[model samples]
Target: MKLKFLFFAISFLTAIHVFSQNTYVFLGSYNKNKEAESIQVFQLDTLNGKLTKITAAKNVINPSYLTVSPNGKYVYACTETKTPNDGNVSSFEFNPENKSLTFLNKQKSGGENPVYVSVHKSGKWLVNANYTEGSVSVHPLLENGKIDSLAQNFQYSDGSINKERQTRSHVHSAVFSPQFDYLFLPDLGADKIRCYGFDETKKQPLTETKNPFTKTDLEAGPRHFTFHPNQKFGYCIEEMAGAISVYQYENGALQKIQRINTHSDKIKEGFESSDIHISPDGKFLYATNRGKENNIAIFSIDENGLLTNIGYQSTLGKHPRIFALDESGKFLIATNVISGNVIVFKRNQITGLLKKVGKEVKMENVSCVQIKKI
Candidate 1:
């Protein structure tokens, strides 16, 4: 009887391995010239957390931010260039079965240095942020996933402080609300989280009262923002301030509720940070700290939707510019840009801690990480 039970257990484990969908991770590559960069994909085993190379690094300029379409049939990214002289966005149709990517086309983002790109919930609009040009651009979609004509573009002239970093309005990120009614554009240089009512094709500015959106602290320089699954609370990661701020969002406006530092109050030196994400379970929040201190800050979201920094783990690599968690919440991956590698980590859901696993995977100038199911 004992022998038969052991055999059954082994059979179940093997079955689990065979049926579980492969976790796919994409690493954005930069060759330092902002040209000739590429996107690499890896297949992660759900049972053992093993990552296997699916797609080798292919030359595609500044595919920094990528999004797999709603149907998972295509992958889109920012080419971060206009053409001969301006900036634009690129869309690529992907074949998961063969693990190959085909170039679709490019559309002008209407601004320079397009750093952040996101597909709208409706799957009809692709929004982009021009970091250096301090503007926002929107592109329409086509049936074949090719980039269509430019739908709209907006630029704000105001800028914030930190003369060196915030000399001009640098819009770092643009995202949509849960209702798909408004767009959240975080301008690091402008010291504002501007709001716009998004329509089918164009978005208009929201009136102050009938909205749940408002600007943040003038000098905070917000880089990324994530909404609570409930859509009641939100968090914004401030790159310049090295902190995270919580807000209560309703209707279409945002009200600051709390602000917490992502680092320990130790000896002070400037530490630039990047990338912030909430776990799928919505129980934990994580942010990557760059500069001399390359670490991942772990925080717990309270009942009131405020974030309290619990601890931080060193990335075990360099310049962890971006990180992503597996779909099942079993593992996490962080991309080290300057070190030219990607590190895998096992996540403890109970404590919200990260543990290093296996070896540091080699890559080149990896800037972003995106995890999806096979």
Candidate 2:
């Protein structure tokens, strides 16, 4: 009887360990064919970096980007991308028990080609950046995970040095500050990082801060902005120049502190840097470069929030548009848009490097990858 009780205790502990190592990976893709699936859900094995398909959500056209709510109960996606004068932001209920997504409702995005969406930590607000129409929209999230109509809209008309790519304002990403009191929008075309104060209690929660914008270098084309884990610094990846601009962040204002190139000296032209993410422990940073240089640049952060480029890892696929690290910080997954595949990597926590692992998941034109622990 004693031995049987001991075995039962050990088995219970083992079951809990296995359940803790599972995470959900969400992939958003561009539906070139109208009947194709737009969003997919996969179960990621955090222990080995393996992915098993759970299900896919269809009927939404061009769900290019996705973001999960703070509670992990809902997912929001930007749909109908590149549709002239018509773009929408859709919401879905995420059921972790069954591992499926149910379509809730969608609202007009207030502009064309909504490329990015971010939810506030309170799960009360949702904001999106419109790439083609050069606008920003704010929405109130209902209690049932439905998105309210657009509460506020802002438009910008500005251009930078690049005549072709920077001819007009192209807001690429909308990110919330660590404190959840501000929102930052990285404008690729205007070469500026726009800031706004956020107050969740009010009807219109977005207000202009004292220092509204931080200007970038000429032709830099800032694409994505990510805050450091310590909340003392922020990093922006430039799409056109293949560089990262580091900033000292305080109360919605950004002061540039360091500027670093993400590529080697041998590569000269065709730099299309896409995504930026920092490790959970605040020790390392990683950025993805597309176009001619298809690699992920690895960097180490110091005590003063400065980045020192350590090395680069080939993505093993072409056109890595976005990559995400799981909540455990042990697995990193990247989506190759043009290559039509998803690659998983084993992350080294101490050295801050990535090793390709597991089999590649095939999904045509996958644009964004996000992981959430449920």
**Highest lDDT scorer:** 2
Q: Compared with the true structure, what per-residue lDDT tens digits does model 2 show for residues 1-374?
A: 99999999999999997766558999999885767878999998776788999888988899999999988899999999888888999999988778689999999998999999999999999999999978899999999999998899999999888898888999999999999998999999899999899999999999989978899998999999999988999999998889999999888888899999998778898778899999999999999988888999999999899999999999888999989998778988999998899999999999999999889999999999999987
Residue 83 shift from truth in candidate 1, angstroms: 10
- Superposed model 2: Cα runs more than 4 Å off: 1-21
Task: Estimate, for each residue in 1-374, the C-alpha lDDT of model 1 and write its tens digit.
Answer: 99999999999999996576566877776553533437777788666677887664345676777777776666878775433356778887777788787778888778887888888776777888988888888777788998788767878787766787778888888887788777788889977887877776444333223552367776788989888877898788888888888989886688899998876678266687788888878889999888868999999987799888888999877888878887778788998888888888898998999988877788777778888775
Error of 2 at 371 (Å): 0.3
Assess every candidate by TM-score.
0.89, 0.94
Instruction: Give the residue spans of candidate 1 off by over 4 A.
Output: 1-20, 32-37, 81-85, 201-213
lDDT of 2 at 53: 92
For model 2, what is the error of residue 315's alpha carbon versus the real structure, in angstroms, after optimal superposition?
A: 1.0
Clashes of 2: 0
